[model samples]
Each structure stands twice: as structure tokens, then as C-alpha cells.
Target: MKQAATASLLAFTAGFVDTAGFIALFGLFTAHVTGNFVLIGASLADFHPGILGKLLALPVFILAVAFARIYVLGREKRGHDGAGGLLVAELVFLSAFLAAGVAAAPFTDADAPLTILTGQLAVVAMAVQNAASRTVFAKLSPTTVMTGNVTQIVIDAVDLLGGASAGAEIKARLKKMAPPVVTFALGAMAGALGYVALGFWCIAAPITSVVLIFFLRRGAASA
Candidate 1:
């Protein structure tokens, strides 16, 4: 349950699954809002989905937060994953959802109900991961987000050179941050490989995600 290993598992899994969501589910990026915006905008301009699709996805970001709070409450109620457990369960749900999506895909084509259902499912997962990462890493700092992580790494590097007391904190932060960066990169690489080798066999996303979560939950238990 080293921080490094936990990050390695979560980041790689996030990237791999998020990339799969993007590839298989038409352009939804499960983790990052930057990519989400690009996809949503394009879909709006082109597809102009009925309120149902947007309605389905509209509250996902909010729902992610709600899910995080639910985890928070779960800990408060039973004191399980503590605050960190919230993040762990978030990843756990994503893994479970991906499995559901893999099984549910055929029934859902490019149509509204199917897309809406799938979008809602993924959105809920992203919402959980997003809020959990934001809170869990507030102290140690979380790197599950590549866009923010890269930006902060630059900022931290600058702060490290400032000869301030906070430099120690910055260095500490970067140490925790490193694993996610590396793991996410590996996921991106693996995603490309899987897409090439498997083609429509995108079932790799959910299956590998389940494996990652299984290991992650094991790590969390021992943590």
C-alpha cells in the first residue's frame, strides 16, 4: 500500500479505461473535463441530441460529486476507507460500471437511449473519481489528472527552486505525483496497442479495468 503503487494502479487504470470510454463510447472522456468539453461541443453542434442525452450526462459531473460524498458519508457512518476509501471506492465503481457497459453495449447502439444510458453510467464514474481525487490528494496532492498534474509539476518545480519552507512540501508533493503520471502514460500506450491489435474487441477496457480494480481493492485492504 505504498502511495506510489496505489497511484500506479489508479492512474494506469483511469487512463486505460478513460481512453476506452472515448474509443468505444463515441467521444466521452471519463476523467478530464477538457476532453469532455471538446466531445460535448462537437456532439452538440453535430448530433444535437434531444434533451435526453444531454439530460443523461448533465448531472453526471454533479453525480460524481454526490457519489464522492456518499463515500465520505459511508466512512462517517462506518469509518471504512476513511477519506481515502472514498477515492478507492470511486475507482471500484468505475471498474464495476465498465464491466456493466461491456455487457450492456450490444443493446445500446449510436441511438439516444443507449448512448444516454452509457453516458450516464460513465459520467457517474467520472464524477466519483473527480471529486475523490480532488479531496484525497488535497494534502499529499493527487495526480490522477494529467492536465492538472503536468501544470502543477511545472509550478511545483518552480516552487522547489524558490528556497522557501514550502519547497519541502513541493518536493513531497512531486514524489507522490510521479506514479500517476507514469501510470497514465503507460495506459495511453496500452490503449493504442489494444486498439490496434483488438480493433472492435474494445472489451479490453472493462475487463482490464476489473482486473486493475481487483488489484487496487486488494491493495486498499492491505493499506
Candidate 2:
């Protein structure tokens, strides 16, 4: 239950920061890889290289996942510490990036170095969020984006309640149907509220996530 709560809060934080990036700079959503992939393609053709943004995003996100996987594997071999805390670290860095951006100036300014640096920070944070979401928690809400999760949830509900299958199949369908429905909604609601009310301090989302990480880490240490 506690882990679920942690994942939910982190997911919400990811979305909140990503949306802020959307509002502040390009409407490009850093967490939504599917959309970002398309954007990358469009960018190739259009003048929106957004190249630096994508550059920061793609590789760092991959590395975050790799690092988390390695950490989680070590914890697993040692027989303690679930895979969650590594992700929490990722989220903390993500929040730091977003907060830094909040402290930065408008994009219209020609200060290329600071702009690129902070801009990279923002997208890379989201990239880490994406990697954590999709890679770390298969059943959990991966934040950043929801097209795939939303589609699968609808498919499960309709296929199950639609009565195409029976008994075990129905149970299995519903079982699969469960997590994303709740978590995604939770992420959306929290993300909306945080970004709306807090502006840049919307970082409170991951701050809450860090608290969860602390508890999870304590559990590992005790074990």
C-alpha cells in the first residue's frame, strides 16, 4: 500500500513537471515518449531541432533505467531493498531540474548557454521519469504520458465487461485492468493540481516522493 502511494505520488510529480515544461517552453511533453518520438521526427523535418532537448532526454533516460536496473539487481541479490528507491533518486533529480528551470528566465532570451543547460535539465528529468515509469513499474503508472496505458485500460474494461470472455479470462482481464486506471487518474489529478497551484514549486510532488523513498530505503536497511 505504501509503495503504491509512493508510485502514485511520483507519477503525479513527473506529469506535473512535464506539463510545466510544456507550458513554459515548447508544448513538447518530455514524459510522453510516444509523442516525443513523433516530435523528434517532426523536428527533423521542421526547424525545431529541439535537438538539444531530445539529445538531453533520450540518452539520460536510458542511462537512468540502466542505473536503476543495476541498483535493483544488487539489492535483489543482497535480498533487500525493492527497486523503488533508485527511481526515487531519479525523481529527486527530476524535481531539481524543474525547480532550476522555474528559477530560470524566459526562452525568448538569447542566452544560449544557460538556456541550453537548464533546458537540458528539464527534459532530462522528464526522460528519467519516463524510463522509471515504463521500465521500473510495468503494472504501475509510468507518468510522463498515458496514451498506451489509457488504451490498454479501455481495452481491458470493454473486453471483460463486454463479455467476450468468461471466468478465468474475465478475471485475468480485470486483473490486468486494475492498476493503470487508478494510478493514471491519480497522476492526472495530482499533476493538474500541483502545476496549477504551485507553479514551479510544483516540485512538492517529488518532494513527497523523496519522503517515500526514504521510508523504502529505511526498510531495506532494516532488513
**Most lDDT-accurate candidate:** 1
lDDT of 2: 0.59
Per-residue CA lDDT of model 2 for 93-142, tens digit only, reads 66666666677745564225565565556655565555555555555544
The positional error of residue 84 in candidate 2, measured at the CA in angstroms, is: 4.8
The 0-to-1 C-alpha lDDT of every candidate, in the order given, reads: 0.62, 0.59
- Candidate 1 matches the true fold with a TM-score of 0.71
Model 1 misplaced stretches (Cα beyond 4 Å): 43-55, 82-109, 136-140, 159-167, 199-223
lDDT by residue for model 1 (124-205), tens: 6666656656655444335346877778888888777877678778887788777688888887677667755664355346
Query: What is the Å distance of residue 71 in model 2 from its true position?
Result: 2.1
Lowest summed lDDT across 10 adjacent residues in model 1 is found at 48-57
Clashing pairs in 2: none
